[model samples]
Target: MSPFRKVPAYCRQSRTPIPFRQKQNEGLEALNTPLGAPRPGATRRKPAERAVARTIESDDADSLRAGRRRLGVVLKPAAQARSRNKLERLLEVGLEMMNEIGFDRMRVVDIAERAGCSTGAFYQRFADKEALLEALAQRFAEKAWTLLDTMLIPERFEGQPFAVVVRRMVVVMVRLASAHAVLLREVVRASLRDMRTWTYFSAMRDHMMARLFEVAGHYPEVTDKAAPGGPIELAVQIILSSLISRSLADQRIIAISDDDYAAELATLMIRYLVIDDAPWDAALSPTVD
Candidate 1:
């Protein structure tokens, strides 16, 4: 009925006697000695003491394994501060080399040489040139997001006119783009060929879009059209694209000066996001003297 057989009591009990040995006899003799009385040689530790010693050994082994796990691949900042600094120097050297020779042409040995470290040291931090590039990209992304956070605060533009806010935003965006033009160019180029690079860009774009949406919500004109496909999203995409393209392009090819371009772009965006009654041509056209 139970679909199982019960074990006999004798079968469950261990009946085989342990073989006697010289070590066992010595241990027994040590236990038989009187407490606090000296023995002829080394006395055997008590079972409880032995167990505690084993537990301590086991705990130490476990702690070592955990430390190795934490320190794997990446250097620990606290325990390995010098290693972390070496890694950072490698990245810095790699970034400079990338800017000079482009990512594909850059080599790990060159980076190490420039950093005044060995190739072994480079491998100790990064697995390869691509790994170092990824670290550079991550560093750039963190800095760009930090700059975005400071510039895109809606409260900073509170009570200001839409044109004033757009002007400030465009100025900051253009300035940041110009400052990181070389690194951003490499990142954009890598994104076109590498899925990981593309994913990083996509995630950053999504975060920026979300922030832009939040800022757009402050204005009723922009908020009115803030559905799935919205003018706010389109405006953000166009503004960012324009800034990036301009930053990556030679300045000589552009007809307008940087200041004029920034001003016109800001006015164009403000007109699109606000000024509901103005016609498209009238809003975008230059005023006659």
Candidate 2:
């Protein structure tokens, strides 16, 4: 009676359609089969392709190792630079404290404070005030050696004129003294009163003179045959004695200009050592009484 109606078929079927279910089973079997297993259209990897893949993987590992090594090298300098910066900061603070408060008045606390660090940091960098002073002295020694190398080294003066070499050397010495006047003055004062300080200064002096002797003696112009003992000792004694004498005498004088002092000392030196055209060997050899 309703507008929408259901229809029923009363026809009898001879057998249930088992073939339809079998076909569905076959389709599911196909679905469960491994892909690219001798299939009609699927592709499979060849032995050569597998070998290529292994080679690529090996190359990738090697490239990664090379990259890490290069990165390590690049990072190494950054670490060193940071360490150097910290050391420089410590040295700068220590030097500043010494200049402002005087070495005797400078304390580990003050230096560390100035450097924005703990006193422990100062200890890590320097054992004590004396150690810092020694470090400063070593720096000066290296610089002095560099200057000496320019003028006195055999290779540098191989074909140079003796007069030119001597003039340049005197200038270098004066410049070094001027630049290090404060440190030198402090050392000189301490050396006059303290045996330990004197020994330290004497050791440094001897070391420098030994090098000078070696270089000067090597020069063709000042060979051992021409100058005997080594010009190094003679030069050191003359320079040191003159410097000490002038410094003492200046203390007695009210005020003497640097020019006047230098001229006086130079004149005395030339009179004593440069008067005669002495053989290079005689000039360099050990000093006489």
Top model number, lDDT = 1
Candidate 2 per-residue lDDT over residues 74-118, each given as its tens digit: 111223666556656876776666656667887878778878888
TM-scores for all predictions: 0.64, 0.53
Candidate 1: what lDDT? 0.66
Shift in Å, residue 30, candidate 1: 40
Candidate 2 lDDT: 0.54
Q: Over the stretch 54-93, how does candidate 1's per-residue lDDT look in tens digits?
A: 9888776566643232211343332466766777788778
Which residue pairs overlap in candidate 1's backbone? none
CA deviation > 4 Å runs, candidate 1: 1-79, 255-259, 274-289
